[model samples]
Target: MFKRILSGLLLAAAVHGLTITKPASADSKLHEADVKWQTVVNNGDLMPTAACQADAANCRTFNSYNQPSLNAKKRVVFRARSKGGKGGEPVHGVYTKDMSQAGPIVRVLDRDTEVPQPNNLSAVFIEPPSFPRIDSVTDMIATRGNHKPVWEYTLADGSDTKVGTTGIYTNPFGPLITGASKLGAVNEFAFFEVPEFPGTPFDVFPGSPAVTQGSTIVFKGNYTVNQIGKTGVYYRDLKNQSLMGAAGGGEKAAVLIANNTHTLIPGTQTVFGSTAPPSAAKRQAVFAGFDNEENPSLGGIYLAQLKPYPISKQPMLKTLVSIGSQVPEEPKDTRFNRLGEGVSFDGRYVAFWGAWGDENKIVRLYCPKEGNKDRSAYCMSAASGSSQDAVGWYQDKSVPINQGLFLHDINTGETVRIARTVTDFSDFVYWNFSGRSPGAGEGEEGDEDGEFARWRSASFLAVSSQIKRSKDDTPYQVAFKARTGALDTNNTYQNPVDGIYLKNRSEKSPFATLIQTGMDGTAFDPKAVFVDEDTGVSVVLPVTEMGLERDGFRNGRLAINASMGTEEAGWAGIYLGEFR
Candidate 1:
């Protein structure tokens, strides 16, 4: 399907000549190959810079306007002239260097330029692929006989030197360089082709060459010729290293690879593979739903149960709940309906909650098993018509209810109000608060105002402001830990920066706070909250504005946001924290 879509798009463009400026066949060929010589140059845009004039005084030009560095040294030094007035310039030039021959200095004319002429001259480096913001510059050195001339540069500390020469030489990845040279005194510059790996192409997707638990692996393979009909996800086992499961019909769909102990619903499209769970209790779980139509509808979440005996047999899938629909008696005053959903640590309960249009409408539901007939749903609201949202779970027993907190007993199907009504929760405002039952273990400690401190055995909570005070309205973030009701209402933590917030387990003074300010338009948002079971240290994973929207430490190494860079949409990644 991907190939067909790409082919159709390309064929339509070819037939209609849809582009505004059509290039010659030769130019098209060059563009396809990224060939530099075939690029059309606009004479009006060409202006000589100081580096092009050979005068150091004139070269005080802004580095942006200088000929781009094509080598590693990042030194910009090259000039070229063309016969045709509007013709493109050749990216090569000659330079003179004095070398030590015995004790005497010898002035030698050299071809120090290392640009990939004609083939890659049209290439522009907005940022080095590996190093962002660093520009590669152009430089030339002397050629010795048939061998490319080598240029030497001293390190920044001046204690070490590195040498690079012109002519084709294999680079760090074994790419043959058509031309090359050294840049400045500290940088190494070279232009080389991307080498094709031999043998079974090293699978870039399944980076480790084997499938394992907790790995978001990608399977990549190359064919000498393109296969038209064969496409979809295929898997191989680590022990046998043999093809196991194959799901067809969709492009870019994900296979939730889990052990055999996991369950699935019946009649759902899924591919089964042979792999025993770590224990007799564990099963592999995979998410395999595809919507191909342009306006295809979203399917509800499904639970699949895997059987160990027949590895090729499809798993059993049980429909849990639909995200597209709202509860039947949902209040109309609330702008949004559903809040958030997650499974319990024991995977025995799937909990969900959301705010109705009105402040008085708060609903919570629990699905205990795949198709339990006795399961039921419930709603909770504040008497003052205050809005509510669920944050997360406190322990295996209680789940965090927004606006007002509630305690529930899963075994008895009973719930009891744990805290007083949150009076200050408004649309634009948020209040930070923490609460715990009287006999809970030592709470995670933190500062009183939720600024900083560690709680020993408590839980922390934060709330946003309801009102918009100014154009740059500072979002109020308050935190507190208490044994019963809300924390100190007067000392709410407020900051214009969105990232920083406070956490506490009990109403007692907080031990520490988490705060982060945006730099250069980058802001962070806290994602997950973790309270140390032993030390009372509260850890959080916050989403940064950079590459990984969600990042946090757990144990020590960072965990990837499974939703990141995957076909699954709208899933924010999860981050774990380290002990230290």
Candidate 2:
């Protein structure tokens, strides 16, 4: 598994000039290869910022960190947001950094911490609204707790646990069969009162919670029960910490795999009108639903398998890539019109995010000159303006989107298309705010407090079908993040190269830009120091954002969240890389 976790590590040869800086920069052949680049916490790096409890903002450092994850002993964990906190309320945390230790970045929960359980019922944490999951082999973290459910912890015995809960779960561990009362009310981490529909509770938990390597806890439960609402996809084994689903507690704590009443729609009998939110490995799980709900393009991408527990029947789903089918290299029948709730499983490779035809292309949406109504003043006077003047003047004409990046080999069904959007990418997806939706407020398009507009996209494909290359066994390997297009320069769409790539189907070299972003920031932190935080002058910047998620890859290591190309304020943070 992952090469026996690096069985006797000491292997390097795959170096191909990509300069982490020292002269070397003609794009360092596209920047970075033998790897080894570490800096897991940047943006000035001081620490402990999150205020709201009062008195804690001398204006520290770190103000952003993204999804991150990684395990197999390189331990990374992420989801941050700090930077000077005088109780103006934006601390938010979930840190952990130990790329094999020199230590110090720890905090597994913040926003004021404190949520031990319902016992004294004091409840504390109010900020982890998503993205946090570690445990590739027990680094244990699984998050989701803006105020009440899915949590796991145990970063060396800080021991948290509330594996999945919501409304009424009195079983802090006491009775079940014989007499039922240490104070009763069992259903162990009940996830909003689910006990096979007894009184009905599932009020909402629409995804973000998938921690497998034996600690199980895959989730996606939803609302309404007697009034009907439906929507499901669950699993809760918490590896012996409790809620193993029903033996002595006899109330069915979790196990429901797929529910839109009864799960169908594999090839297409239809039924599940809503699913998404899943991604487990080795014990199987992989999702993205919609069975019509009046045509969500028909929806696809399945796979279930998962058996164990007192459960029986119902689990074998399979599908893989659906929405109308066909779509392989495209141009003949070109099917798959769309499919992306997210999927990135690595049990045997899945990495999804598809789209096939008809969105009418035409994207020219660049920006970097806030304030002063200038429509790029004639492409910034035919490219003579330079100073980071990216203004391209919004031309999305209200709607038209396209995306691609696929790879599915469940063994051999084969799918492969890794990167697209005008071909090889002009952005394979990135959205902290894309307008008209997410939380849109000001002129009121959306995304302010409605949160969730942040995206690195396509669930951040990180595939690994056993990562072989054992000299040509070449099974697979992938890592992604795009923005390149115009056929990689020569056709130049202006600024068309922002990377983080690596592809190795045994490497004939179709991909390997290990993180290029306008090049030279010490090739990516040799000693870094790219000022201009306000013309303190010495500038270089480059990296305009890069985050990767599918747990940010493992064993060969990857964890990133770059950013630099600043509006000012200490570049940006978190980096790791490794892979030799």
Best by lDDT: 2
Tell me the TM-score of model 1.
Answer: 0.24
All candidates: TM-score:
0.24, 0.34
Residue 381 error for model 1, in Å? 50
Total clashes, candidate 1?
Answer: 96
How far residue 393's Cα lies from its native spot in candidate 2, in Å, is 46
- Candidate 1 overall lDDT versus native: 0.22
**What C-alpha lDDT values do all the predictions have?**
0.22, 0.57
Query: What's the true lDDT of residue 479 in model 2?
Result: 85
Please, what are the lDDT tens digits per residue for candidate 1 over residues 1-580? Answer: 4444334433433443322132222111111111111101111123243234575432221111111111222111122222212233222222111111111111121122332321222221111101001111112221111112233345556765323221211111112122211221222121111112111111111000111121111122111213221112222211211111221111111232332222222343432222111100013222222232112133333334433322534344444433243433323432222222111101111222222233342222222212111111111122212233353211111122333222222333332222222332211122212222222221111111111111111122322222133232322222222221222232222222222222122223322222222221101112222234455553332222111100011111111111111111111221211111
lDDT of 2 by residue, 429-500 (tens): 553322123222211212112223222224366765544234554366678876653432222244345577
